[model samples]
Target: MSTANERARMTDLALQEWGVVVGILAERGESWPDTDVTRWGPGVTAAMERTRALCAACSIVGATEAADIGRLADLYEARTRS
Candidate 1:
């Protein structure tokens, strides 16, 4: 569990890392195209959905935990590796 401040910080960090992932994908010719899932495939759609879920969790009180943030970081790493 994390305090509100901690969750806020973690969420910001996760989003920043996600932004880096998106940039890397863009370099590889994968553009997000602003919510147009048809522009990308299911994998990218899943990543974006995860990002949106993180944001949703952060908005609700006590919804986001330390482990959740860690999972997002791990997901980012796995995406980068593959």
Candidate 2:
């Protein structure tokens, strides 16, 4: 079994990873055209909120790994960046 300190450390790392994902998502949202923003903006915002919720709830272990989140952030940046 993991100690409380280890769990806390994992949570912190997960939140940091989520933060990177959120930032990339925000950048992706900013790149959307105004016409399509109406339809897509809410979805992006929801995704951001969900990540924050996951971090707040401290669901790190089997939920999502930091490396996975980093990969996702990288994918978002690559696909959305100009």
Candidate 3:
């Protein structure tokens, strides 16, 4: 069995991986454009919300590893955001 700290590290990896995936999905969501499918669509928005939840959960991990992922993601996101 893994030690407590090792398990915690695994959890942090999971959270941060989810965070990066969430960021990717969020980036893809931006390309949908202002079409009827984007504006009048419930499914697309629901998916976006679900994807965002991964990132939200990452914040709750509160681990240094997860935080590092968030920081890296933020820097990557900044390039895209600009």
Cα displacement (angstroms), candidate 2, residue 45, comes to: 17
Off by over 4 Å in 1: 28-36, 62-82
Lowest summed lDDT over 10 consecutive residues: which window, candidate 2?
A: 30-39
Clashing pairs in 1: none
**Higher lDDT: candidate 1 or 2?**
1
Deviation (Å) of 52 in candidate 1 = 0.9
Q: Per-residue alpha-carbon lDDT of model 2 for 23-82, expressed as tens digits?
A: 655566643123243555665666556655655444444333323444434534554475
Q: What is the Cα-based lDDT of residue 59 in candidate 3?
A: 47
Segments in model 3 whose C-alpha atoms lie over 4 Å from true places: 30-82
Q: Write model 3 residue lDDT over 1-82, tens digit each, in one string.
A: 4455754665455444545455444555643223344353555555545534544544465433333444535544554578
Give the whole-model CA lDDT for all candidates, comma-separated: 0.59, 0.51, 0.47
Rank order by lDDT, top first?
1, 2, 3
User: For residues 1-82, could you state the per-residue lDDT of candidate 1 as single tens digits?
Assistant: 6587767675665666467547756766764443445666666666666666665666554534323545555555565589
Q: TM-score-based ranking, best first?
A: 1, 2, 3
Q: Which residue pairs clash within candidate 3?
A: none
The local lDDT score (0 to 100) that residue 23 gets in candidate 1 is: 72
